[model samples]
Target: MKIHFSARTIAFALTSCLFIGACSDVLNSSKSEQLMTNPTEVNITSIDDLNALFDKYQYNDASWDKGNREVPRITFAGVDERWAEGSKSLPVEIKKMIFFRLMTPLALVSNENILREREIVKNSPLDAEKLKKIALKYDILENKTGNLDESMRTALLDRVDILPPSLALAQAAEESGWATSRFAQEGNAFFGQWDFSGNGMKPLNQREELGDYRVARFDSPLASVEAYMLNINSNSSYLKLRVLRSKLRAKDKAVTGIKLAGTLDNYSERGQDYIDGLRAMIRYNKLEQMDQAYLSDNKLIHLTTEK
Candidate 1:
C-alpha cells in the first residue's frame, strides 16, 4: 500500500520547489543590469581603432587611494547571445564594433602631460627594479594593467572614474610601443593576439593556420583599444572580471577597472604573469589619462558573426 502525504505537506513542497526555481530569475531582475547596450559613441572602422579613442582620454592614476572616488564610465554594447563555431570568418556586422568606439567616455583627455613628466618614469632604463618596487609597494599596479599613478590620480579627483581610459591607453602604449609597432600601425592590433584562422596578416616569424582567419582590425588606435576593453568585460574567458563587475553593481558600488583586472585568467594563459604584464604597462607608462576621452556620437555597428 502506498502511503499518502497530507495535503498541506504536498502543497508546501510544491510551493518551495516553485520558489527555488524562480529565485535566480527574481534575484537577477532585482540586481543592477550587468550588461547594457549603447548607441552613441566614437565612430570606428575596426577594433584596433579603439586605441586612438582611448589615447585621447584623460586618466588620473594618482587618485586611486582617495575615498569616494567617481565610478568609471562604460558603454554597453548589448551583445545578444550569439555564437558560431568553426566559421573561419568574421561577419560584416563586426565592423560596427570597430567603427564605433563605444566605451569612450564623454570627456576631454587633459593628462597627456603626465606621461612626459620626469618623476613618473625610472631614471635609467635598467632601473626597472625601482619602478617595480614602487608599483608593488602601493598596490597601484597589482591587477589594473591600465591604472594611473599617484601624480596623475591627483589631477583626476572629482573628474569621474575614467580608469578604463587609463587601462586602454596603457595597453596600447606598452603593446604598440607608443603607437610605433608595425602591427599597431598596420593591423591596429595592440594586444599581440594571434588569429588562428588564415584570414588576417601575421607578423614576422608568427605562426599561421592552414586556413584563413580574421583578427579584429580597426581604422584607429582608439577603436582597437575600445574593442579590447569590451572583449575583456564581456567574453567568457574573463569570468572573474564579469563576476566582479556584477558584484559591484549588485551592491550599488562602482566597478574599478584595476580591481577587475585580478579576475582576468583568460587574458593570457600565463595566469598571474598576464595580470602583472597589464599592470606593469599601466604603471610604467602612466596611462591613467586615457579614461577621459569621449565618444564621437556616430552611429555604431555591432558584430553579428563569430568563429
Candidate 2:
C-alpha cells in the first residue's frame, strides 16, 4: 500500500519541518528543514516488494544509468528486518546492488545537509552569533573566543564540508557488512562508532582496556550516516583527512574519495590495510562516479515495512 501527504495537510507549520526520512534530526539546518515537505510512503513486506517499488519509481540500480547520475529521492526510515534473512537467498551481485541502492540516498541526503551547513560557514563573518553556534556544533574546541575571526571561519570551513559519497558508502559496506551485522540490524549503527556513555550495544569481544565503551546506536539509517559524517568531519583522529580535503579545495581540485581515503589510516586498527580495503571497494564498485550524483527534486519517497 502507498500513501501521500502534502506539507499543507500535515497539520504542522514549515518551521518545524524535519525532512524525516532523508534528513537527520541531529544534523538539521535551515536549508535541510526546507526540503521534502511533501512525502510519499510505501509499505513493503520483503526485499522483492522493495525492489518492485524501486522499479516503479524508475530508480536504476545499475551504474546510475551509465552516468546519468540523478538518484531518485527514495529513502528508508529504517531497514525491514526481513531483508537480512531474505537477502541470503540472492546472489552476491544482486545483494550488492540492493545494498548500494538502499544506502545511496541516505549518503546523498547527509551530504546535502553538510553542504548547506558549509554555505553558512562560508558566510560566517556576517553573523558572529551564528558562527559561534556553528563552531560549537561542529566541536571546534580551539575557538573559545566570543569573536568570529578569520581563523575560526577557516577552521569551521575545514570541518563543515561535504564528504565524498564513495568513501561513505565504502566504509558503511565494510563496517556493517552491508547492513547485515548485529549492530546495523539491531541499532542502525552502520559505521561501528563507539560510545562510552553506557547507552550502546556491547560487542561480543570488547577489549577490557577500552573500558565500557559500546558501539553507538541510532534511530534510523539516515541518522547513522549523519553521525558518521559528523565524526569524520570533527573527530581529532581524522584531522589529517580534513586538512587534505582543504588542500584539495585550495587547489580547486575535486576532493575525491580515493584522495581522502589515503588519510584514513587512523580510522581503523588495521591502519594501512583497512585503508587499502576501502580504496579497493571504491574502485571495484565504481563508487567514485557517485560523487557527482544528486537527489531528484521530486517528492520524498519513504520506504517502510507492512505491519
Candidate 3:
C-alpha cells in the first residue's frame, strides 16, 4: 500500500529519454507533434502541472528508441483527483500523452517485479518447497504438499513472466478511458476487473443479472497495474495467452505484444472485437515501442504526496 514517487532526480531522470534517438521507426508520425512541451518543475497540484512536468522531461514516443529506450524511474504515489477533473478541459492529444507517461513507468516497474519473481522460479531447484508457496501465490498450485516437479516449474515459468507494455497500455487506455474513468479516478481500478465481494464500487449501469458485482479497486495506479498483470499471468481466463507466450519462448521467438494480444479473446464479452480494438490502439499509438523501454538505473526517488 506504500505508493511511492520522488522529486529529487525526477527532473533529470525523466529527461534521460532525450538522449536516445535510435528506437523503432514504427512510431506514429502523425502524433509526433504532440510530444513536445515546455518544461515545468513544480509540485503536481493539477493535471496541467503534471502535463508540464511530462513535457519538460520529453516523456513521449519521440524520445523512446527501439532498443535503447530508457525512461526515468518516476512514479506517482497516487493519482490526484484534480488530474481526472482537469484533464477534461485539456486537448485530447495532451490528455493521451499524459496518460501514456503516467501509466508507462507503473507498468514497467510492475513487469520488473514480476521478472524478478520469474528468476526466482527459474533458478530454484525443482524440489524446493518455496516453489510450492510461489506457485500457490500465483494460483497454479493445487496440491499443498509435493516436491516441485518439471511440469509445475514449466507452469510457473509460463505464468511468472513479464507482460508486454504495449498490451498493458492498450488495455489501460481502453478500460479506464485514458485514466479518466470513475473507477480509475476514485478506486485506481484501471483494468475494469470485477469484484463480487462487498468491497468494491458498484457500477452505475451494472446488469442486475450479474449479481452485486463491482469493479475491483486498488491502493494506487501501480497496484492496479500489478493486479492486472497478475490476473493475466495466473487467471484461467488468460490461459490461452500464457500458452501463446510459452510457445513463443520455446521457439526462441521474440514475444511481442501484438502477437500475444491475439490470445485475449476471452478477456471481454466482446471477444474478437475487443482484441481487435486493443490491437488497433496499440498500432495507432505505436505502443509496441514501449515494450522495449526500461527504467533508468537511478536511485529510487520516493515521493509520498501528490500535492
C-alpha TM-scores of all predictions = 0.40, 0.84, 0.78
- List lDDT for all candidates, in order: 0.38, 0.75, 0.70
* Error of model 3, residue 69, in angstroms: 0.6
Q: List the residue pairs that clash in candidate 3.
A: 5-302, 5-303, 6-303, 23-65, 23-66, 24-66, 39-56
In model 1, how large is the Cα lDDT of residue 262? 70
- In candidate 2, position 28 carries an lDDT of 57
Q: Enumerate clash totals for all models, in the order shown.
A: 54, 0, 7
Regions of candidate 2 where Cα sits further than 4 Å from its true position: 1-34, 45-52, 55-58, 61-63, 80-82, 141-145
lDDT of 3 by residue, 3-113 (tens): 123433233233321111111111122232122122112344433444454444555444544244776555554454555555555556655765687678778878877
In the order shown, what is each candidate's alpha-carbon RMSD?
A: 21.9, 7.7, 10.5
Question: How many residue-pair clashes does candidate 3 contain?
Answer: 7
Q: Show model 3 residue runs off by greater than 4 Å.
A: 1-42, 45-62, 65-68, 127-129, 143-146, 302-307
Tens digits of per-residue lDDT, candidate 1, 214-241, equal 4555544434554464455334575566
Q: Model 3, 3: alpha-carbon shift in Å?
A: 28
